[model samples]
Target: MSYPRLAGKRILVTEADAFMGPMLCQVLARHGAEVIADAGTLADDPQRPAAIVAAAGTIDVLVANLAIPAPSTPAVEVSEAEWRATFAALVDPLPRLVGAVLPQMLARRSGKILLMGSASALRGMRRASTYSAARGAQLAYIQAVGVEVAPYNVQVNAIAQNFVDNPTYFPPEVQADPRFQDRLRREVPLGRLVTAGEDAEFAAFLASDAADHFVGQVFPVCGGWVGR
Candidate 1:
């Protein structure tokens, strides 16, 4: 007996120990989605039970929300080695994770991939060269992959956001500084930071049957920050 609202849907979330990761998993699970806690990536553990897609069986949905810091202190001050490491950490593992289940999704002709991106990537930032570069590249990847899998009924899309209260992935320095908050309030028309559950809610919708028409879409949930 499958539940219509997401009873048997298998959802795999990365960075599970982080604020949004675990929180989204629980929310999805409560909504009837069969949530798979893919927390191994956070530990850098290459051998967790659900470390790879094959191990977790056919995943109905995959949410990749991993983040890494740039090696260089500033864009100008950052070294080549640090840049490479930053991209390596930010981009390299995705193929490994998605590659494992993408084939199966193609075979099944239905699946969804949600990426947690940032608004800075949509519009470049001054000090976030490394991070924004990686995120921009990720957005491009989402577009390409979305088109590639569209024929198979697989949707690949990204959610570009500015501020979510979820602090697990937030850099400590930024949290402590009020200047960033002021700027955020000024730039963001909503006048408040984004909420984690809102993101999870949108993700749930994208993963559901209702979002069949969505593909190659970089949905910006940035509270009007990037729209202007």
Candidate 2:
């Protein structure tokens, strides 16, 4: 029950200002972890690792949460240039950051890396094909690297969240629209949106010994949206 219990542990989180990141940091600190958050959006001028590496010493945990939503339109309507940028912004940076710190952790033989993924990886989201595709690639990458790092006492896993009620990821119009809300309410068995704090708590557990058995896994944090 008291999982996070991350007292004195140092954790690094990217996209600290996003809907879920800061909230997650608070939860980590509440569990006694020393949270270090900085501006590390994959789209930022200087990437995540650059900022994170500069913030402090080597990290005990890393949370990679970056996403780039391509323009909503048919896949046939998307341009090549736009698609390339989306792939880089969504799929590339997280791995680079992980690769950067993973060796250090492996050498020490103790670390947890929780990368943020989406339920869209299960099946593509209607208009957000690019985001889905990028995440799919991310899912594959995490699995491979997770296997390689597990032997070194490093843990890697992805958390796939469905539709969480957050302004940064969801538009204000959509958030307040009762028609759209009712539609999603019917889709998810929980009949409501996933809260960031709840997701953070689960993530904190993954970052702790509580989730030692969770390796190379895609833990669906969605409220039955990606399953029956």
Candidate 3:
């Protein structure tokens, strides 16, 4: 199906080599968006997000696709370093990226910022304290920023997703495991992993003009995993 929802729009997708980045760029481009895929990490170097936005120049949409390998340490065993690192990787770069692009969007009185967040924040998960906390911070930031910028015609929202088909979280080897299949049937109401294309298409809709009415909203794309 042809969706020219984002025709003539320039979108900047961060962490373009990882997480939802690869699929998001492909899908947005298919929807007629000019995607600026930046395969750079925003951790440690605080200046990186701004640098990426500055380089992209005049972006109509910002896809914050930040991610890291989720650490599975138990809550009691999660160290301070683990906590800090997880936040740095998944949470810290958010504001910096928004800060960079928001000025332009606010000035122009038009823009969209879609965060590829996680459902782990909305639902409880064993051995994911640090990772879940960081993801939670991301959603909260989106909610606050979404409302703050909505009046300027700049919408900020998030896709809090899990159980999606992607190399980062659900790689081939993992999906091939029978235990994983059993888990899917037992946990996810959809009884399957949500395809990358399905998730990205929704993201394309959110980034387009069609989704302007939505603000400070968290859309869960977890194949109904969060519902259970």
Candidate 4:
């Protein structure tokens, strides 16, 4: 399916080598978007997000494709360092990126910010306290900022997803495990993982003009893992 909607649009996708980044870049490019894939990490400096925005020049959309390997430490065992590290990887860069791009979008009264978030934020999972907290923070921030930027014609939204076929989260070795396959059947109502291309296509729609009516929305793309 050709998404002519994104054609000619300039989009910057951060963490472009990880998570859903490469698939998203490919899908958006296939849809005719001028995609700038940034594989840099936003650690070591608070100003990195702004630098990234500046490096992308003018953009019609920003896909915050942020992620980190989830730690399985028990809630009682989670350390402050772990908590901070999780947030640093997933939460801290959001506002900085928005701040950097807001001026340009607000001036033109048009832009889109689509977060490639996690469904783990929307639902509780054992041994994921720190990771869940950081992901939750991301969605909350998007809700607050989405409404704030809406009147200016800037859309901010998120796809809180899980059980999707992606290298970062669900690699071949894990998928081949019988234990993992059983968990997929029992836990996911759809009984299978959603494809990466499918998830990226949803991102494309959110970044397109067709999604202008949407703002401050957290759409779960986890195949009934986190039911509305």
Candidate 5:
């Protein structure tokens, strides 16, 4: 539970009230990180990311915890508004966040940037065209920027995940439903949901010095549901 490498580390997690935010903050703090949990909206203003970084001051790690409700509209019915909105919520802020934080990290030549992304980008899902596209954009951005930042020893990576127990995706009510449980067993090779704590632990590891060798990696954390 203790990560000396993360002890005294300053980490900023966006949307801290949703989608792995609370658990991430709790785990990182338990491991001795100075977690700045920002439960705020970013897409409302392109400048919000930079403002957050400035407010948080010295950031050793940035967890871009972005999320929007997945659209269930069929591909043909997916409107331009939905598509643009999804990207605005999920894709646009990534560069802004990195732009805001990279200078400090690059100056020190040490920092971690971890994106909380979705496996829908890695695999196809029914009724998720807009969400999948946005998630895919996030993965691509991470891969490209991860390498770009590596020369400065600032690692960038993403946790491409789904089927995790989180309020944003799978809530207790959904888990308790028999149909969802049956589908979960059929779909997820693990035969159960990955706990938020487990996912947060992985995020904590990635933020620690132990993950220095990783760069441009889109790690799939959806149990056996997503691979390669």
Candidate 6:
């Protein structure tokens, strides 16, 4: 845990206040990275991603930790507005962030892009149609871009997670619910949510030079929920 695996690296973490952002910044910094924690919204402004990248000059890693409250509307009841908003919040900023930071990374022939995605995309979930669709789009984009940039040594990958402890999704009230506990035991093979630190530690590994060989991979951090 004390190893300086990310020593002297400059990392830019987006939406640093939400999702896995806080824990990720803390863990990456603990690993000796100079983390640029940006707690900004990229959904409202299309240009914000570029601005964030421009502001965080010379980034060795980009942690795209974008998130929003998942809409639980049934598939047939999912409105166009809900769909658009979901995509805007979860999927749209990806290319913009990449476009802003990738040229520099490619020029240096080095850099890592780690997306904090969702496991709902990899498995079916009732009342999660909009959220899953957008998340799936994100993973697809990462896969395509990851391969395209891998030859240039710019690795792009994602962590598809669910049943992971985070305020954005599984807050205190939800965790304390008996129904939720029963569901957790019934569905997740691990029998509990994956801790935030565990998830963040894995993310740090992915962002480190140690993970340079991985390309376009979607690592699931869902406590075996996807398997069950």
Tens digit per residue, CA lDDT, model 5, 5-96:
58989999999999899899999999989999999768889988989899999999999999988899999999999999999999999999
Clashing pairs in 4: none
Once fitted onto the true fold, the runs of candidate 4 whose alpha carbons sit more than 4 angstroms away are 226-228
Writing each residue's lDDT as its tens digit, candidate 1 over 61-137 gives 88887766433366678778767766765666666666767888999998998887766687856667887887788
If candidate 3 were superposed on the true structure by all CA atoms, what would the RMSD be?
1.1
Lowest summed lDDT window (length 10), candidate 1: 41-50
lDDT for model 5: 0.92
Question: Which ranges of candidate 2 are over 4 A from the true structure?
Answer: 1-4, 44-51, 226-228
Better of 2 and 6 by lDDT: 6
User: What residue pairs are clashing in model 2?
Assistant: none
lDDT of each: 0.74, 0.78, 0.93, 0.91, 0.92, 0.94
- TM per model? 0.86, 0.91, 0.98, 0.97, 0.97, 0.98
TM-score of 2: 0.91
What lDDT, from 0 to 1, does candidate 1 have? 0.74
Q: Candidate 2 local accuracy as lDDT?
A: 0.78
Residues 1-228 of candidate 6 have per-residue lDDT tens digits of 779999999999999999998999899999999999999679999999999899889999999999999999989999999999989999999999999999999999999999999998998888999999999999999999999999999999999999999999999999999999999999988999999999999999999888999999999998885343
